[model samples]
Target: MSVSEIEKYGKINNMYKVFLDIDESSESNVKPMLTNIASKWLELPNGFLASNTMDGDEIYIPNLHMINLVIGN
Candidate 1:
């Protein structure tokens, strides 16, 4: 899903979860791959929401107060 869509409706109990499912034997490559994926997501439009992984998937969710505070000013 696009970052915006994910941000709009991609949370469980107010947190985003991402998972990296590489084999435990391939642990060395996981960090760099995840970092690249994160960078690509950051390049998406309206992609400022914090992102993280759980169990091998990436999740994105809105930052409510941050958005409100920015908009309120």
Candidate 2:
């Protein structure tokens, strides 16, 4: 989802989750990669959330791509 789309649904009590589609990345490697992305982007919905591992997928915190935000990725 784009920044404008996030601004609309990203609420104070809620959040959006951005997941990196990287299969080769280890848990340790993902942290830096995600940080790099965040550093380049200044403004966020509710600011940066947290990096998390869900069902084996590494996801960056403070989401940018939410399913409900847009129709498709």
Which candidate number has the best lDDT?
2
* Candidate 2 lDDT tens digits, 21-58: 33443544544545544433222353333223323333
TM-score of each: 0.27, 0.24
Task: Pick the TM-score winner.
Answer: 1
Candidate 2 stretches greater than 4 Å from native: 1-25, 40-73
lDDT of each: 0.33, 0.36
Looking at model 2, report the run of 10 residues with the lowest lDDT sum. 64-73
Q: Model 1: residues >4 Å from true position, as ranges?
A: 1-20, 40-73
- For residue 49, give model 1's deviation from the true position in Å: 11
